[model samples]
Target: MESKMVIRQSIGFPRLVKWPRRVGYAAALWSLIFGALGLYWVLGGDGFPFGENDPRGQMMGSYLANLSVHVGGTMIALTGFLGIFAALAMVRKWNQKRLYFLLLFYAWVMCAILLFIIPDSRILQNVAYLFMFYFDLIDWIVIHQVFCMIGGVLWGTTALAYYRISRDACGNCGRAGEGASIISASKWGKVFTYCAVLTALPYGIVRFAWAIGIPLGTENIAIIGDFSGEAILGGLCFGGAILTLALIQKWGEVFPRWCLFIAGKRIPIWLVVIPATSVSVIIFLTGLKVSPQVVMMIINGEITMKNWGEMVPTLSWLPWGLSLGIATIAYYLRRRSRCKHCGKF
Candidate 1:
């Protein structure tokens, strides 16, 4: 009887914990550590993670690469210090509407800079290379950028928690005194879902054509020197495009009958959300890095109307990422079961 009671208590513990508080504390702790690192750099520490201190920082085109140590370090340290206060305020559920909005703006802007602006295509390229059994491409810089992204995610989570808490909503699920269920939001979800799918087609189609030696957009067949890499990347794009459709499809919620095993079983929500969200961030970062260069090239007349196809597809990544993210959230909202923490569906 005692052992059974202990097991039951252990099982119930997770559901009873206040996740918002925990997430807020985690955000504060991350800010503290990051701030300490900045201070260390300001004090002449050996291995600063940004700008010229990073070996590949220039190649990655990190905006921080140009700043001197003192300037960058001070900025980082200040942001970290401010982040701590922001995180703590969210944790405490501070109810001042004006102050909360200010913090929300700050948090989201920081999140966008960290997650979208700061990172370049190198991170995604490195991951792709790794999957292709090319290990040398994975380096410390990539890991550092990943660390930055983690921090961004934490801040975003803190902002979200604060948003819900301020509105007196269930922190776990964001359900409040509402007129309709989250499933009702699926209408907009489908719109974004299809938008994401359409954006993927251009890149995928061009790559596929190049792989088949067609040179659909470029001038000459020689321009498409090698097709193997193009083929692999094109396949990946198509695969991603297909998987994205699952966001609005019935298969996303349950296993299909075609599967030999686990058919009809409910799919784990995080299983889909985590990968989708990560890919969306990566695509957005890649587009953010490339879009400026592409625009400059167009302005300089280096890339003209005749060759628009080559560069135009790259521009689609930003919107594609954003749409996919919204679609994923919509999928989650539509499929989420009753909240275990707040007892709200």
Candidate 2:
């Protein structure tokens, strides 16, 4: 029987495992660096402005022109990148491990660009549409559904891979094969639960309103055409939330009642761990990419884009307010925990 390894003090990052984690870290770091550059361009007014007369008045010149899209997008992407780092740091081995987390992170990178960044960018919109048109012309392609199709496929594949991995015994198990649930707190589980709630609740409210024929405002349109997308998004939110909650009490560690043949059986770490880690990694890197943009905007008020005021509500204040609130709560929570190393908290 293999002897159990005890992980004590934090080992140097390089001493850890290879592949995904290392690749994830590199990606995250790159994003952080470039996101800063984008932010600098937006804030410094290095010729990117909003005035119609302003030759640089492309996307940044409209009602949607806001720093949040660029900066917020980077932050979202960076968060996923960080998730990857966390997963790699936590895991012990990587044999035939699925790359769901990494792929999800990539999808998130696309989301940050599409959801928050590109929607507001005239340049990006034109570029994207141009490509879409060309691609569609070359082949029979539903350009409008590209993002959804790609994201759905990635997430779907990851989810199925995770289910398969859960059946295999965890490599990190002890000699007697004690499971990860018995040994460590599931950070990925907790984080995933939190993310789903954060993203789904708000998105759900908007989606539900669209479902019954309600509108957030005159301009806000339902992204999900018909109820199919609404159902899928809502389902992902609900399912992910349920699994996370179950993990809190170890129910998820063992497959739940609905997994057919695998129901009521012990699940593998790679199953949940891989997907969770993949999503996190992707999210963290993407978030890192946007982080610089956020910081830059906050530092300098030089958004040369037109209709900057139109974006004040959502991009600038709302997310900042939420971030501040979350920070405060996190600080208090950490303080209450009284962790020895958490001096500031």
Candidate 3:
């Protein structure tokens, strides 16, 4: 058995060696393509996506909304060039401490801008709308946002691969001869799980109240106009809350008997991780765009404590997203099996 395991690992090791390089090359290509597009825009291309040219206009309130086409385009092109260099260096494993940390910092900053700062509430809303068959609602702007998010994911992947390789860790599993990862510890898993659940509740509860016309914290009856949307959103919130509990539950690993055909089977990891992570990112980005505006409104007396229901749930989104993301990571750490590529367990 030991010999067989060794042979399997030897076969897999070559692929592990190649994985980071492949990802790094991909990131470079992405940077090249996107950067060229930015250059085109800078050279008087007509379709600049942000500022007054944005279809949503001031409604988006994007951080890029104030920048001129030339300025934004120049910045984009510069980042793209930087990204190419970074990607190549990472692929080459240029591991000098200062240079490595600088590249890592650049990668994360790009990830944050693309993933969280550039995108706004529209992306989240349009995604939900897409599920509801509101096809007409999705436009070029949403598609652009999606592309930015994809870039963010790519940058994030590149960062992880670079970090693991530079640190001489297992490229596939990131295990450096560890007994267990701190993030995967059972206690931390439970803590983050409960935090996720708790943060989600206030929003769900408030939405439910509005759905039922209870006006839980508001005196305005007209706010209840068309309770259907509220009900659906409330249901989603509660459903999400319930799903969050699975991070700490036994049934998260094994399907319960209540599940018909899949009963007694171990759950697929990606099935849980992908959707949860996607939703968490969207929620966090939307909250990043919204929470500040809501706070400003409150301070300016544009929103009042009497209408707390309207704004408090919105504020919860930031924490809800953060907690959910951590909880999902914890769950993944606890549940992941031996790395197929590097034979890390």
Candidate 4:
């Protein structure tokens, strides 16, 4: 009877790592290695990290003395360096959940901000220019995206792990509210959801066009057919938009009977939050990375309406990224404040 009671009250979250401290040590090593590379990028040859033969290296010459690359490199190096401490804290078994969360979140935000600020031509005009030349300059853009994307996955999954390890410390310390006093649905939440859906429309439409064989660029139709890979990502964006709608709907608060044994149970806060937040991080990193370059091209009169039409879906990424972040954060706060037991945060 006591065990049944405990099960009813417990959140049922699973442990991601059998040894958190060991994994933390591994993460620390990984972050340190990246930090070292970032250091090289700043202090290495001709201020471009790679040689003049690199695409990022080539782009450096267009600017006034590679100033932007230096600043971006320094910023990345700093974040990567600081990240080691966060991972190390976990290794030391720090009881401060907020401290760990803050450190990891800061790393994610700094990397995302730097990605948007750097203005790499590889993400020029809002679409990731992946297959342009294949190899020579590929590392420039590939590293930038891979770094940010990896950080997003790392920090997000780390957060979920923390929640499972220490639910109370990680913001699940909440209980039932007064009978007449309940948290109301937020209007801002609805607004952000609508915004995400709206912004996502352009991208979905473009992908649908491509899938149906509409050629938007100089790439041959069959060559474009090879771009079926992009269609999957676009589908994910649309899926995210649909899921965002749930944040503002009735289904988000309660489970339907479809959920087998857990039917009609109050939805687990972590379940919804972890996935939504993870997707938001990914979209923000991807979409915002192209914003500075897009704006610069427009300001310099290099992008006309005709050219913009070629990548119409990408234009929506900026707004979509921002709205997704806002919506996810709002959802998290609302859920955390209403955990079924222990009304403390």
Candidate 5:
């Protein structure tokens, strides 16, 4: 029922767009423009075009640098402008839910095909490179295509839901109760804790190896240098994820009494919601960025693509869906409590 309600609210916005939606639209548009520019630069060969070093390589690279970067940037900018316009539409009470959902679905389809077909299938990879400029396009798809689709839709939808919640008869008073004991009331708390630990495992192993001067074989990651852009982006995401989890552990719906510092303090939703939402948004958008290079070992020719297919369901869709759902529910509960306390409704 709540999901249905959200769908209705989302669809209803176009009739009267709001400033908040407008701002989100602006942000989305900015991302789209930046993405387009990046894509264009990639095609023009002005920027770094890896794996292509010959004269033909240089020539192709050069052309893309000139044309795609400029053209792509313009296209991207147009998207950003459109987002701003959409936000205005939202404020004006024009529903944009259908558009947002369609955007997200489109993005998802793109990511799924890219992840499933290209990396594991030699035929697909070769074919894609013929016209797609796979290397740079891959990154562009991850960043702009995916990011805007999810962020625009989710934030737009969430903000609208928040507006509705503000107007409805809420169930809980805004008592950010002593969170010390709140965490133990349900199985969900344990699930969150377990998930957090699982998520941190890879980071822990890598960091530990690094601190001890052990070559963790993190070479493939290319966390430094010309191709370091991916690493930088991933690092930011990983860091944001860590920060979000910490907030959840400390200030979530229920903080255990054994916690320190803000033991009982109600964690600000921005602390948890913003970062959690961000990760969900990014992960969904980027399809987990599981490139051919990243998973080459596991996705080798010996491995049937069908077998590898299972990985996508787990890595790309499931985890983010679970986390997003949980974090959203938490935010809603908190928001409802706050609204009730303030007697806004």
Candidate 6:
């Protein structure tokens, strides 16, 4: 009740955001398409996408390669099946209450699983890369991640919209507080926002120093890959932290004076929502390596928890993911005018 009350008290105005119906439709359409392809592959007699006596298998090693080929395939097929209902739930007019609720529930559950439980198991495969190879389009691990990325965006955003429309209509309400900040999140949202910003800076600074040939941790530069790549990716992460401010600041709603093309114009909500929502998934995927992975290794006696050097830095993934996700949801709610159930300001 306090949570509900907080939402009601937070919004004292009658402004509304223009929900991106077109994006929702596109996601829905793709969900069905991707889901069908997945179902076909799963049911088909063909072997999994990777694995077997393939040259590509050599890149990721035996354990991780086989895992992706087998376990990842199963996950892909399951995600594809859910994608069908997820697409259908995007409809505001869908009459079947149970199905509608179920779809929303499934999307949220899958997102959590993707974000927390079975995080993109690409770390072992990535052990080969000196720098992050996540954006590499050709890698099989990257390919599987790409599917998860797309599905997460569609599932996460569609569920966000559903809850925005009808409070009781869907069990998955996207974020912590309902009737939350569609423009800017609540107090918790701000906390997470700052947390993300602060955590991102360390990586950016470290990478920048490394890029400039300033030896901080290593004496030999030969060990590092294109320092420029680290600098660039790190910069992107750092820059993303700045973008999170848009959730709390007016500049997010209006153009910063820098872009003369559309200065002071209201930035399209989709522009922020789409990227922010998608990044949240990646944040979790990356964070998983630190938290659960380390714990599992310790549990299995692969490593000792006492020598926790990378642990602290790695834990940043959780806050980054949480803050980004919360802030985006808050931004959506803050800007949107109508409530799902009340249908009133």
Note the clash tally of each candidate.
1, 38, 0, 3, 45, 14
Candidate 2 C-alpha lDDT tens digits along 1-345:
011111121123334323322343444344354345445544543422223323322323233234344454445345545534533332333343455455445545544443333222232223333533533322111232233233333333333333333444321111123223321233443453454445434434444444555544324353423465444444543454455444345564567687889797655434555454333333233233344554466468643243222222223223322332332223222212111122111
The full ranking of all candidates by TM-score, starting with the best, is 3, 1, 6, 4, 5, 2
Which residue pairs show backbone clashes in model 1? 51-65
**lDDT per residue, candidate 1, 41-160, as tens digits?**
899987766667666665555666666889878888999888898888778666577898998888888788779766677887886676567778666667767878998998898888
Error of 4 at 296 (Å): 3.7
Whole-model lDDT per candidate? 0.79, 0.37, 0.80, 0.56, 0.40, 0.59
Ten-residue region with minimum lDDT total, candidate 6 = 168-177
Report the lDDT tens digits of candidate 5 across residue range 51-134: 232123222212222333455445544554444444334333324566555544443443333233212222222323434345
TM-score of 4: 0.58
Off by over 4 Å in 4: 1-31, 35-185, 213-234, 253-266, 299-302, 305-307, 337-345
Per-residue lDDT of candidate 4, residues 209-234 (tens digit): 56666655324455245456557645
How far residue 141's Cα lies from its native spot in candidate 2, in Å, is 16
Please list the residue runs of candidate 3 whose C-alpha ends up more than 4 Å from where it truly belongs after superposition: 1-18, 55-58, 179-184, 219-222
Pick by lDDT: which candidate is best? 3
- Across 1-345, the per-residue lDDT of candidate 3 in tens digits comes to 533543453463466456666888888888887798789999998777788787574565477777788888999899998899888887766747899999999888888889987778888787766656677867766777788898898888889988988888877678778537744467787887788788878877887888777888787888674577777777777888899999888888788999999898677776789999999999888888888888888889978768878776788889889989988988888777666556676
Q: What's each prediction's TM-score?
A: 0.86, 0.35, 0.89, 0.58, 0.44, 0.63
Tens-digit lDDT string for candidate 6 (1-345): 433543563354323333324445656666666566556655664544455623454332223344544455566666766666566656564667787688678878765654444435353234324345554534654555556556566666666777655553322233324454433345666776787788666656655666776654444566355576668756766788898888878898778889899897667666888778767756655665456655666578755443333233456666777778877877776765444434444
Whole-structure CA lDDT of model 2: 0.37
lDDT of 3: 0.80
Q: Please list the Cα RMSD from the true structure of every candidate, rounded to 1 decimal place.
A: 4.7, 15.3, 3.6, 7.5, 12.2, 7.8
Q: What C-alpha lDDT, on a 0 to 100 scale, does residue 239 get in candidate 5?
A: 56
Least accurate stretch of 10 residues (summed lDDT) in model 3? 1-10
TM-score-best of 3 and 6? 3
